[model samples]
Target: MQTQSSFKTTETGTLFLVPTPIGNLDDMTYRAIDTLKSVALIAAEDTRNTQKLLNHFEIETKQISFHEHNTQQRIETLIEKLEAGDDIAQVSDAGMPSISDPGHELVKACIEAGISVVPLPGANAGITALIASGITPQPFTFYGFLPRKGKELTEAVTTLAQKPEALIFYEAPHRLKKTLQALLSTFGVDRKVTLGRELTKKFEEFIRGDLEEVLAWATETELRGEFVMIVAGNPAPDATVSAVATESLSLPEQVEAQIQQGASPNVAIKTVAKANGLKKQVVYNAYHELTE
Candidate 1:
């Protein structure tokens, strides 16, 4: 129940979330440049990588490391500085902060401390690839990166497969083939997909086709740079069938049924819990017949 008036005058310093260029330097907005030059301190994901951008823009503002590994350690210090009315700007190596980057924790801390959080929108790879993907872009979900583990990945993809909106995912070149294969198995061979490689760069390329075609192309081609994948939604989701299948079964029985269909216990619990609008722990406890 907290309201944030971004431009309102306040004694505490504002925490600016600045976006850097995803690929093309020309995409960097003037506002982003001005903020970078003006902030008291720049909390960057990687100081070395960000220094290159600072040098290019002639921004001499100092930077402190604020990545995943050092997030908890840095939040206290950053909050202290903001409380003292020294404005700070946070940036990632590229793209918007906290969008698959390391600025979320700091942003949360700032909110909790009642510091102003100002976001300057600029380059974003997900939306950049989406518009040109030729897929319906209105109802799209930006799923940053999928779980890397086998069981976890299966559960995540299974849940996302039921959604009716276009799904966007980011993947490294090394894991591109495996992720595409995972999507092929869950989304089926005929699902429409587009793969944008090295987006906004000189060697940018887009592959548009069905899942099967994209999988084949990934197998034969040598992948380089990062990629953005746009997967078409399920055109004919059978929600009625799912509802009917679970209505007659007890919660534990419903979980058992999913396991019989080859889902792991955790995955089965998640599916049944989501279907019944209950928590996973509740389903897990019921399925295991735990008294506590």
Candidate 2:
């Protein structure tokens, strides 16, 4: 009663890129299971993780380890099978592949070899968290798990300093506090932030607030679950060219006057920095500005 494309062995015989659920069993799609069962091979980031999923659905398709460590040596063998018209399905341990995962090169090789790749719609913790974050809900950038060291993390955040899009970042539970702290220091404590944990799982939660508030909340409670962080979009500095509270104004009265003229103290400092050809902090030091 199923269509001819029910399994991976459609008339095309292309490789299907499947996305497994991040943490829930019920999230599995029907077409994904049928396709996994039909494919001649199931290339996975972790065979053991995929094993549990396969066993749950009672799928007997053969599993192969195709993670970052050994993919270079295995691509040739995989290509041989594809050339023989044996369709396969590739999956990551969780969520989508090639997005902070190791499937990009493999997928690229398949494409270059004249083999087709069909991506199946499924779960991605980042996008899922973005919608639930209730941030600006506009264009956002996704930066998967950040570099471990503080210096490298700084470089990463600074690289996007001028980007006006909301940013999404994934972080481990242990590194969550440090990551937030680093973001706060680099982006300023007042930047709005949303943190998503245990997404799509029973303990799912989203904490939305300014960076300082959220950072304090994180410290007061025990942090757990996979984290998806959405940071407020960087404001376009060009718009606040007349920010007067920032540069030469050292008194609260002067800063407050600029605020009444529709320029946020932060934006004003940034604007004055450009006008005076100096650093923003250099300008803000004279303004004595802090929202608290």
Candidate 3:
């Protein structure tokens, strides 16, 4: 447990976590600009991208590349600078760092090394989209970007399916359709969902409706830009629905049942794997043995 009284004493150089605009340069906060200008060094995910922002504001601070690929190597250098009383500001390509982006490792390292980490709030795609999504925003789970494939993805979707709060997920355009299909399978086709793309920019658009409709729209439309998916939480099951619908069957048995009901084996595996919090491979091996 550590208590951070930021700015109370400048004995050590602070590590500032500054948020840049997701899009629409004007969304960049005054405080973020000031920090970027004031810091000794700006460690950015992409120096070229950040340089553009810095130039726009006439912030002459120098930047070094710090991204997922070079995080381990760069972290040591950043920490050394912090230890040497050189204040540093860390920014991602856009929005907040460590939110489905780099900087988490550096923050962790700073905490362990007893360095001060100060975060300046600015633009965030998830929260920005959520407020406008017309979905219940409070008590929402921000589950960043879901795993790409296999049991991890299935289990992640399944976990979100059981929660009563709104769910937020980030997805690239290429994978958006597949993720929506997976959600349709787990959360049912009628579950409410909203898609926010190119947020805060001129091309920003929001698609809101049932999962099936949204999935169809996404499939037919020309996909582009990053997406923030705001999905309504699980509705309360009707009391009339049989408890046996859930409790009577074990996990492997459940997979077999879904397969019998015309679900593909892969789909059933994903759904069941998520429901059981087991790996897809584990469920697959068990299901095959059970059938054989």
* Top-TM-score candidate index: 3
Q: lDDT by residue for model 1 over 1-292, one digit each (tens)?
A: 7999999989999999999998998898999999989989999999999999999999999999999999999999999999999999999999999999999989999999999999998999999999999999979999999988766776787778778899999999998887887666555567899999898899999999998899899999998999999999878664422431355688788777666544688887877676666788998899999876
Q: RMSD, each candidate, Å?
A: 6.6, 8.4, 5.1
Q: Which stretches of candidate 3 lie over 4 Å from their true place?
A: 237-292
Tell me the tens digit of each residue's lDDT in model 3 across 115-163.
9999998899999989999998888989998887545565566567777
State the TM-score for model 3.
0.84
Which prediction has the highest lDDT against the true structure?
1
Quote each prediction's TM-score: 0.83, 0.78, 0.84
TM-score quality measure for candidate 1:
0.83
Give the residue spans of candidate 1 off by over 4 A: 239-292
Backbone clash tally for model 2? Answer: 0
Report every candidate's CA lDDT. 0.86, 0.76, 0.84
Judging by lDDT, tell me the better candidate of 2 and 3.
3
